[model samples]
Target: MCDTCGCQLHEHHHHDPKVVEVNQSLLAANVQQAMSNRQHIEKMGAVAINLISSPGSGKTTLLERTIEAMRDTVRIGVIEGDIETERDAERIRAKGVPAVQLTTGGACHLDAPLVHGGLHVLEHFAKGAGYDLIFIENVGNLVCPATFDLGEHIRVVLLSVPEGSDKPAKYPATFKGADLVLLTKVDLLPYFDFSMEEVRKEAGLLKPDLELMALSATSGEGFDAWLSFLDRRLNR
Candidate 1:
C-alpha cells in the first residue's frame, strides 16, 4: 500500500470476478481509443508526447520555454490538462501556438477519451497547416496519469529539485513508465539538498536505459539538450 495515498500498488488477490471484469473492460476500451488517437495524430503529420509529473514540477514553464525556442522551426500544438482552469492553455496561447485546455472537472488524471476531444480542437486550431509535434501535459499527478496511454509516441516524466531526489523510488510506477525523465529546476541544486547522483541511480533501477536530462528552464542551463531531443524525435 502507498503510505501517502493508501492505494494498493502491488498485486493482490481479488475474489470479486465482476469487479475484475469491469476494470479490465474499462482499460481495454481506453487502449482502443489510445490506438485510434495515435492514428489520428499520425494522419495529422505529427508525433505526440505525453508529459506527466506532479504539480509545481515546472511542466508549464518547460513548455513555455520549449515553444519559444522551437516555434519558428517547428509547428507545435499543445493540450494542457488540469482539474480546473484554462490558465496553462492561455500561457501557451500567449506564445502564439495552438493550445487546447482540457479541464477534468476534479478528476485526478486525463484519460484517452478526454484527450481525443482535445486533439480535435487542436486540429481545428491548426487550420490545415499541419503540425510537427503535439505536447500533451497531463494533469499534475504521477499516479493516475500513468495508467492511461493517451497515444503518445513518447512519455516524459519530470522531477524537480525541490521535490527531492527520493521521488523516483517513492513513485516507482510513474518513473518506470517514462521513456525519458527530466530533472527540472537544476539551477536550484545548490539551494536544495537534492542529489543528482541519487536520482539517476534510483531511476536507473526502474528503467536501466531510461534517457535522463537535467535542465533549468528558468536559467536555460542544459536547455539545448532538450531541444535537440525533440528535434531528433521530429526528424525520426
Candidate 2:
C-alpha cells in the first residue's frame, strides 16, 4: 500500500528503507520531468498555472468563469486532472476552450509525468497556434498535490467560503507552496460562518508574502482582481 495515500500502486511508500529509496528516486524523476515540462510549455508559448484545492472548493467553477472572462483576449487551454471523469474537461470544452482530461485512476494527485503527457495533447488540440495561458486543474486534493510540482509557473490554492478559515492551518504545506491563495465562493459568506480575517491570518502565517484574493465566480464579486492577476502574469 502506498504510505502517502494507501493506494494499491505502491508508488509512494516510505516506511521501509527500500520504499524510501524508491520514493526518493521517483521524486527525482518527477523533478527532471517537471523541468522538461516547463521548457515544453515555454516552447509552446504559454505559461501554466497549477490550481490546487480540496473537493468542492470551486476550482472548476473558477476556471469556467476565467475562460468566459478572458477567452477573447487570452488563448487559454486547460488540462483537467481528476480521479476518474471526463466531466470537468467537458465543461471547459463547452466554454469553447481546448481541454485535455487526465484521469489518474485512483491516485489522489497528479504527478509531473502525467501532466507532461497532458501538455502534448493540449498542444495538439491547439493546432500549432499555441496558447498564452494553460491551466492545470489538479486532482481535487490539497495534501498530495503540494508534494508534486507539475511545472506550473504559478501555483494557486483555493479555499471556498463554506470550507472554513482553518484550512490553511490544517494544510500548511499546500498553502506554503502556493504563489497565490484564492478565497472562492465569497457570495456564500452571508450564509456561512466563514471568517475572512482568520483565513488571512492563518494563510499569511504560512506564507508571509502570499497574494490573497476573495472572489465569487457566480456573482462576479471580486472577480475582476482575479482576471487582473492573470493579465499581469501573461504580460510579465
Candidate 3:
C-alpha cells in the first residue's frame, strides 16, 4: 500500500522532472485533512482525543470504563479503529453512546481522512444526543500511528504494567509526541517488575511537559485524576 494515503502504491508514468520539484512529507495529504478535521470537530461542540497504545494495552477496556463512569454526565462518542471487526464498536454501543467502528482494512494506523469519514457516521448515530467528547481509539500500534496527524485535541499514550517501563525509550517517536501518558493495569503493579519512576523519567525526557496518569480501569485505581484531566480538557 502507498504510505501517504494508504492507497495502493504503483509506478507512475514517466514525466519531466524539470516540471516538478515538490517538497512535502509523505504525510502531507493526511496533515492537510487533519487540520480541516480539527475545525470540524470543534464546530461539532466536542473535544477529541486520540488514544494510542500497543496491542493488548487496554485501550478499549479503558474506554468501556470511561463510558460507564461518565456517560450520564458527559455526552461521549467513540470511533474505534482496528484492522478488522466491529466487536469493539459493539461494546461501546451497549453503553448507549454514539460509536462507530473504522476498520482500517489492514492499515497500521488511522489517518486524518479516515477519521473525517468516521465523524460523519458518528453524527448520524448521535441522533438527538450530541456529544461533548469524542474519543478516537487508534489501531493498537505504537509506531506508525505516531507519524500521522488525526486532528485530536489531545493525544494519549498508554503503557500497561505488563509491558514494562522501557516503552517510552523504545518507542521514543510515539511517546515524544504524546500530550499525556497513561500507565494502565497498575493494579497488577505488585506482580510486575515495572518501575514507575523510570517510566516517568523516560517519558519526561521525550516530552518534558507531558502529563502522566496511572490507573487500573478494572479496579478504578487513580481514575479520579484521569476523569479530572478529561473534565479540564472539555471545559477548556
- lDDT values for all models: 0.94, 0.93, 0.92
The CA lDDT at 174 in model 1 is 95
What's each prediction's TM-score?
0.89, 0.89, 0.90
Q: Between prediction 2 and prediction 3, which has the larger lDDT? A: 2
Clashes of each: 0, 0, 0
Indicate the TM-score of model 3. Answer: 0.90
Give per-residue CA lDDT, model 1, range 1-236, as digits (tens): 75545558645544445633344656898999999999999999899999999999999999999999999989999999999999999999999999999999999998899999999999999988989999999999978899999999999999999999999999999999999999999999999999889999999999999999999998999999999999999935
In terms of TM-score, the best-performing candidate is 3
Model 1: lowest-lDDT 10 consecutive positions: 13-22
Tens digits of per-residue lDDT, candidate 2, 1-236, equal: 77586778866554545533344555898999999999999988889999999999999999999999999989999999999989999999999999999999999999999999999999899899999999999999979999998999999999998889999999999999999999999999999999889988998898788999999999999999999999988835
- The regions of model 3 sitting more than 4 angstroms off are 1-21
Q: If candidate 1 were superposed on the true structure by all CA atoms, what would the RMSD be?
A: 10.1
Write the candidate numbers in order of decreasing lDDT. 1, 2, 3
